[model samples]
Target: MNKNLYIFKNKKRYRVNVRNYNQEDFEDLIDLQRKAFPPPFPPDLLWNHEQLTSHITRFSDGALCIEVDGQIAGSITSLRTNYANESHTWEQITSDGYITNHEDDGEVLYIVDICIDPDYRGLGLGKELMRAKYETVVYLGVKKLAGGSRMPGYKKVRDKLTIEAYYEKVVKGELDDPVVTFLMKSGRMPERLMKNYLEDEDSADCAVLMIWKNPFIT
Candidate 1:
């Protein structure tokens, strides 16, 4: 795979390249994930080097890393799954975080995880990564992209509103939940609300099912 498949420029004019993950990137990617999603979740929920290696070994192009100034700044891991009309929880799609659920002939590109280093936030790298994923969809000839959006802001209002209510507010622009807001702006439509999606405190044990149809696919 070409290491320079995708490239972007941050506001500060730094070059950021999205490329296939290499074995050397394991530790750095682990560190980035730690910083991007700190505690509150069990250690088992967090991916380790071995698990990531398994993913890359199974499907090489399914994982990507972002390089900025010669360092790994962010990474996104995805898998291909058969197109299903119904919604899927994170555990169901990813097989309880094992990530062995990937299928090469699947019809949909499932975005398992995308993380940007905290220091790299606000530089539009996340959006650039999303674009890279769309390119992956086209490369894999998938019909669409699907994933569960973590509601990082849900815990704040979990007491006052139900998960469905909060999802409606976020979709209607009545709330500013970061993850959901980004997905909406990126053209991903909400499909349903997933209960106990993951072990994240920020999401309040819920996630919003999101889908982005590929215009180029048919």
Candidate 2:
């Protein structure tokens, strides 16, 4: 695949290339993931060296990284699955191991994870990465993008609202939720709220099940 370069002017002009992940990026990607996610999720939750290697080996194009000034600042890992009529849990999708559930002929692109370095936030890198995901969907002729959106803002108000209520507020624009807000703005609609989605304290043990259909699919 050819490398895709995205240039934008935020605080200042910058260039980033969204490309396939390479074996050499293993260590940097691991380090970036650590800084991107906050507490309650154990170290094991972060992909280790072996897991990273396994994913790249299984489906190279499914894993992508963003490079800024030649350094990896972000990444998005995904897998293809046939989920049209199936109900899945976070554990089941990610359970077989790191991207172990990847199916080459599947029609749905399941985004397993995404992370941007702290210093690179607010520069529109996340949006660019998401755009790249859509490009991948079109390239592979997939039907949709599906994944769990971590509710980083939930922890702050969990005591005051139920997960469902919180999601409703975010959807209704009554509250500013970090992950959900970004997902919504990126065209992903929330389908439901998932409990124990992952071990993140910020999300308060829940995730917003979101999906974005590929307009070019049908």
Which candidate should be chosen as best, given TM-score against the real structure?
Answer: 2
Residue 167 error for model 1, in Å? Answer: 0.4
Question: Over the stretch 1-218, how does candidate 1's per-residue lDDT look in tens digits?
Answer: 33453344453466677888978888888888888887775667777877788778877787888887778888888888884456566788887656787788989888889998999777777877888888888877789988888998888998899888999999889998989999888778988888887778878788888888889866
lDDT values of the candidates?
0.81, 0.82
Q: Would you estimate the TM-scores of all the predictions?
A: 0.91, 0.93
Q: lDDT value for candidate 1?
A: 0.81
TM-score for candidate 1? 0.91
Candidate 2, run of 10 with poorest lDDT: 1-10
lDDT of 2 by residue, 4-98 (tens): 56566654666678888888898899899899875666677887888788778888877888888788989988888886335566768865447
lDDT of 2: 0.82
The most accurate candidate by lDDT is 2
